[model samples]
Target chain A: MCELMAMSANVPTDICFSFSGLMQRGGNTGPHKDGWGITFYEGKGCRSFKDPLPSAHSPIAQLVTDYPIKSETVICHIRQANSGNVSLVNTHPFIRPMWGKNWTYAHNGQLADFQSRLATKYHLPIGETDSEHAFCWILDQLLQRFDGDEPNSEDLFHYVIGLCKQINELGVFNLLLTDGDFLLVYCTNNLHWLTRRAPFGKASLIDAEMVVNFDQETTENDIVTVVATQPLTDDETWHKMQKGEGLLFCKGQLIYQSS
Target chain B: MCELMAMSANVPTDICFSFSGLMQRGGNTGPHKDGWGITFYEGKGCRSFKDPLPSAHSPIAQLVTDYPIKSETVICHIRQANSGNVSLVNTHPFIRPMWGKNWTYAHNGQLADFQSRLATKYHLPIGETDSEHAFCWILDQLLQRFDGDEPNSEDLFHYVIGLCKQINELGVFNLLLTDGDFLLVYCTNNLHWLTRRAPFGKASLIDAEMVVNFDQETTENDIVTVVATQPLTDDETWHKMQKGEGLLFCKGQLIYQSS
Candidate 1:
């Protein structure tokens, strides 16, 4: 299994505060130590960084925690490597271009026998990971079903939810996917999310001795949503998603929820 | 116009020495100050770093110069931004996955009326740049031509060279493309290359005051080839490529030349 993190905000926001806590779990306080990867969507351009080293000891991970590259959408993953070997190619948060948008995907759970089972021809996985195979498979279905014509947001989200249900039958398939505009999350096991708006207060990390006051960091009108496999902060009220649930977030607001 | 740099080595080698010279041309010594991007291929995995700011002034660029990330194949570009706005999406070294490989491309010359003239359906450009449009068109043709079956290296190189000739007819189209195995270079006006093997000597940069003694940095078996729009080193004897010519290199050795 792996750990996934994603953020969607009304304005360009940094993930340093939350990432600081998550990095501690990658070999320091938790067992997800195989590798780590992140993607920050700056407009239509996505900046991705990946390392095959444990995030707790990686210098590049430290740089990520130090440098605040603000973005409207972000996705991150820390891998424990059940389906693939510990290598740069197998590092999480895989990306591909779809409908002229850079689509990024990260998975938190393991799938069963996804290599030979996957049937994707349009988009192929560069790395041999069950998560990547599943992502390409999903894209293959989406592209083939639409046939290059992107549907409206609501229709696309509903189609994606149906696809997630299909993938969920394979095994645990908690995933976060985004294409700069909409962030779609689907979970089979455990996933949590929280929205921060007006009347924000201080929050403390569960893994690290760090505290951040949202009042000083964000304005009253700013809307931010964070989704993770587990809650990063102890004080924040995270809504735990039920099994086989799907969500769609557009600009930090949840617009669609699976019934 | 943009500046392009690429390297193919028999062993994993750092491009810090060559990049130091290229970084100066981004703003200090030349006029390509719009943006910069680089892709370093470590095995089947590629690590890419990009910034919309000038490479000479970007802290990320400074980190690239300071951190010696070794790679066997590298592609880099510094942009002056003629076709698109100065943003992250318009940065050079556009990448996409093809034939289960991350195919990266960097262009050094300009194209006239490529946006509307390009006819591509499968792969689309996330950024609005003539170079990226051309790249997507090329990939579309390749994928359609092969039909999911990757051709042999020689056959693929011949097809790519033919495609390059077609693209060169439009305008100046000097480009470097790679799939971590083959480094294909096509030139219309300006492109130069040099190979350094055993019995290496000291070389000085043309754009910067940095000098490197290659004899102290390599083993006797190492063979490295450096390609750029302009010769990066003053002392090295680079072979200037002819107009409408294409070359293919594999593991730092030139394997094919245009007929």
Candidate 2:
């Protein structure tokens, strides 16, 4: 199993405060130490940093925590390597171009017989990881359905939800996916989310001894939503998603949710 | 115009010495201050770091210079934007997945009437840059020529050379492209290459005050070749490539060249 974290914000915002807590769990407080990766989206372009080293002590991970890279959408993963070998190729938060937009995906749970369960066509897995194979499978499905042109947002959201449910049937398939504009999160087992808006307050980390007052760091109109496999803060209230549920967020606000 | 840098090595080697000099040219030594990016290949997986900020002052660039990430192949670019805006989407060293391999590209010159010259079908440019349009055009052509399976390396090399010649006709199109295993360099006007094998000696950077003794850093069996728009070092004797010429290098050895 792995740990996944994603963020969507109305304005370009940094995930340093939440990432600090997650970084501690990569090796210091938890066992997810195989590797780690993160992607930040600014407009149509997205940049990713991945290391085949423990996030808790990786120099690049430390740089990420110290540097505040502002982005509208962000995705991160810390791997424990359940299926694939521990290498740079197996690091999570995989990205591929689809419909002229770079789509990023990360998984937090393991799937049983993933290769046989998912049949990919247009997009193929570059890395020999079950998670990457599943991501490519999902992209291939979307490419088949939509072709080059994008479908309506609502229709695409429902289509993706159906795909998520089918993958959830295979096994524990918690997912975080985004294409720089919209962030779609699907929960089969463990996932939690929190939204901070105008009435933001101070928050303390659950894994690390760090605290940040949102009032001092954010403007009143700013809206930021963070999703993770587990709650990173102890003070902030996090809503746990039910199993087999899917949610879509755009510009930090929830746009769709599966009942 | 931008500055392009690429490396092909028989073994995993760090480009910290050359990258240090290139970092200075991003804003301090030269005028390529718009943005910068670099991709390092580790097996089938490749990780890239890009910033819209100037490389000279970018903290991410500082981390790249400080951290010695070893890779068999690397493609880097520092942009002095002419055809696109100074944003992350338009940053150089664009990447796309084709034939289940991550193909990375960086260009150093502008193309006139690129949109008309290149007609893309399968892949499209997400960023509004002539460079990216040209990259997608190249990929689309490859996809059309070959299906999912990879073609013969020699045939693919010749095909790519022909494509480079066609793009070079539009304008200056000095380029560096790679598919993790092979590095391809195309020169229209300014490009230089240097290969260091056994009996390695000291090399000094031209843009920065840095000296490295390959004798201490590399093994006797190591073969490393570096390609750049200009000679990155003052001490090493770099070979200047001829106009409308394309070279294919695999494992630091020249495998094919266009007459």
Candidate 3:
């Protein structure tokens, strides 16, 4: 129903090269043309740019492609508007403050009867999207369990995985969520990921006629991991996640994986 | 110290003319050169653009001046960074969600012994700024009083005014806060406002050499009020607010005032 992209890097890095290919799919090569949004995290500060217009034609989207905003974690989404009307309020990459950190979420699939099933109390959706409702529901669960205190990372990871599996049972629920420190991805139907370290090579876009040599852009010690609903590059070996699987990454390294 | 600017309009209006002048103060005209931020409200959705760079030289700030994003309410700040580091996390115009509405805040003056005076429980500051600490303190009071329930506008306005008075006792606290429906302003020392209605005339900027003819740009039914730390335009008749005064505005009209 939509497309999602996220990046985690050991150093501050820009997603311009991958975003260039994804922007083409917003309206030029694909049908997800309702709206688009992106969030970049710089330390504890998160900045988001959302437009209620197709990314392929949005001047702000063009600015994003032109400006290289370096961030340790980034999340982006292009919407097809399955649950909510095409508006600025319904744009993806929804964000809220949790545990003194800005948590960002983006969804790529539709859920059935989400509003009726998911109950939220502490956090509420500003928009009418089912995706946002689900996100609020997840946060509600977290608040109920942790009660404003920070939980251990492993325990929190497992708790989030259990929540993801329950949401996945309703329908397709591929999700990307991050809180500037860690990125957590859950797959229901489609998701792919790849990590680039030391031995980086050239890559070509699958949606656009663009090529980038990672060797020229990254240092040898730099680690960068990218996750998306679909592979953006044709040459890179993207590892496809199985349904009902969840993964957590911190500083570009996989820290937890659920079998 | 920082420069604060805000607008409340009956209809969606762009702040390009006033922003042009205020941005000049970020570096060229004044000394607030640490960072700058602005938030524009579109229905329940708010979009913010912030840069930890000087607004006079930032390309993002240049784009903000060039692009006319229409909004019914706007809050902006150009920071001098007396209490916090010059980073994105410490930029002005902080936002958080409370009672299902996004509340935006910006402060112009500093606070003394703020960390010791402010005790927060429900919300915490992600950045180390006296302004942000004051904001969290105010919100904490609100949460304690209302407990997630919506309060009557008049009662809420008075309660907020009392809170502002308490914070002002600690130090200088010129504030602008909004929740999409209303704009509340508190003046500790310096604040000015002007309202333009029917029979609008030409206005010129004080910091920048730009002139705008509102008579040709606005409709007769449009009512727009702008508030700033200093009058942005040299020729406009701005009413200076008294110290320890608070005002509430909705739909460009003054609804409540306290001595």
Candidate 4:
């Protein structure tokens, strides 16, 4: 299994503070050390950084923690190589452009024979990874149903959740997907999220010895939502999603939920 | 105009030496300071770093230079922004995955009314940039001609050159494109290339006060081909490509040329 992290904010915000905690889990506090990747979406533009090296000691990961690249949406993953080779292509937070948007996806849990159903026309997996194959399969289905055009937001959200439900039956399928606008999350076994807004106080990392006071870093009008496989901070109140639950978040607000 | 740089090597080689010189031209030694980006292909996997900030002052660019990410092929660009706004979406070295390969592209010149011909079926430009739209147009043509599959080398190369000639007639269209396997270069007005092998010597950078001895850095079996909009090194002899010329290079070998 791997670990996933995603963020959606009303304004462009950095993940340095939360990423510092996640990096420690890559090898220091957890056993996941295969590879790591992150994607930041600024408007319609997407920027990604990936390393085959373990994030616990990767110099690039260190740079990410030190530098702050603000974005409206972000997705990150640390791999453990349960399904694919520990290579650059297999690094997660894979991105493809669809509907004139940078669509990025990252998977946390394993899938059983996921590629068996991967019959694609427009999108193809660049690497031999179950996660990438699943991403492509999802995109292909969306394209076929919508015919190269995006549907209404509600229809798109509902259709995606239906697809996730179909995949979740195959195995554990916790995922985070975004197209530089909204974040879609589906939970099979484990997932948690938290939102920060006005009257913010302090939060401390569970995996690292660090603390950040949101009062000093964010304004009263700032709204930021962070979703992860597990709670990243020890003090924050993270709400755990139920199994087979689907969610959609945009501009740091939860707008839709599966029935 | 912007600047373009690309490399094809027999081995996984780092472009720190050449990139160091190019970054200086981003804002320090030249005026093309709108934005910059680079894509490095290691095997079939690709890692890219892009910034709307000027490369000369970008901390991400500094990390890229300080950390050596070796790759078999690389495409880089420093934008002067003649056709698009100075934003992250307009940064060069755009990428799209096709035929299970990450196709990366960078352009040095602007096209006049190029988007008018863009009638894409599979690929679409997410950003408002002439270079990206042209890239999508090229891919759409490739997909249409081959019926959703890559054509044979001879046919693909000839067809691409023919399409490039058509685009070149519109305006300046010097471009570097790759599918992580081979580097394709199309010259409209100006481009230069240099290949270095066993009998290497000292080379000095033109934009920065830096010198490197290839003898100490490379093995006798290493072969590297570097392409740029202008000569990047002062002491090396670079070959200038002719107008309307299309060249294909793979594993440091020039394999095809247009008639």
Best of the candidates, DockQ: 2
True contacts kept of each: 0.69, 0.89, 0.53, 0.87
Candidate 3: tens digits of C-alpha lDDT, residues B25-99: 998898999999999998988888898999998888888898899999999999999998999999989998887
Candidate 1 residue lDDT tens string, A1-259 = 8888999999999999999999988999989999999999989998888888899998788888998999999999999998878988899888899999999999887777686677787788888888899999999999889987988889999999898888887799998999998999998988999999999899999999999999999999999999999999999899999998999999999999985
- Measured over all alpha carbons after superposition, the RMSD of each candidate to the real structure, in angstroms, is 1.4, 0.9, 1.1, 1.1
- lDDT value, residue A143 of candidate 2: 83
Residue-level lDDT tens digits of model 4 in A68-152: 9999999999999988798998998899888888899999887886877556666788898888888998998998899867987
Residues A72-128 of candidate 3 have per-residue lDDT tens digits of 999999999989899877898988878888899999887888888997888878888
Q: Check candidate 2 and list the clashing pairs.
A: none
So what's the TM-score on candidate 1? 0.97
Model 2 spans with C-alpha error above 4 angstroms: none
CA lDDT, candidate 4, residue B149: 66
CAPRI verdict (incorrect, acceptable, medium, high) for model 4: high
Per-residue error for B171 in candidate 1, Å, reads: 1.3
Alpha carbon lDDT at B208, candidate 2: 88
Per-residue lDDT of model 2, residues B1-259, tens digit only: 8999999999999999999999998899998899999999999889999998889999999999999999999999999999989999999789888888889999988888999889898888999999999999999888888877688888999999899999988999998999999999999999999899989999999998889999999999999999988999988899999998889999999999985
Tell me the DockQ of each model, to 2 decimals: 0.76, 0.88, 0.71, 0.87
Per-prediction TM-score to the true structure, in the order listed: 0.97, 0.99, 0.98, 0.98
lDDT of 1 by residue, B1-259 (tens): 8899999999999999999999998888989999999999988989888888899998888878988988999999999988889999988788899989999999877787787777788888888888999999999999889988999889999999999888887899998999998899999988999999999999999988999999999998999999999999999899999998888888899999985
**Alpha-carbon lDDT of model 1:** 0.91
Prediction 2 TM-score vs. true: 0.99
How much lDDT does each candidate structure score? 0.91, 0.92, 0.92, 0.90
Query: Which residue pairs clash in candidate 1?
Result: none
C-alpha positional error of residue B176 in candidate 3 after TM-score superposition, expressed in Å: 0.7
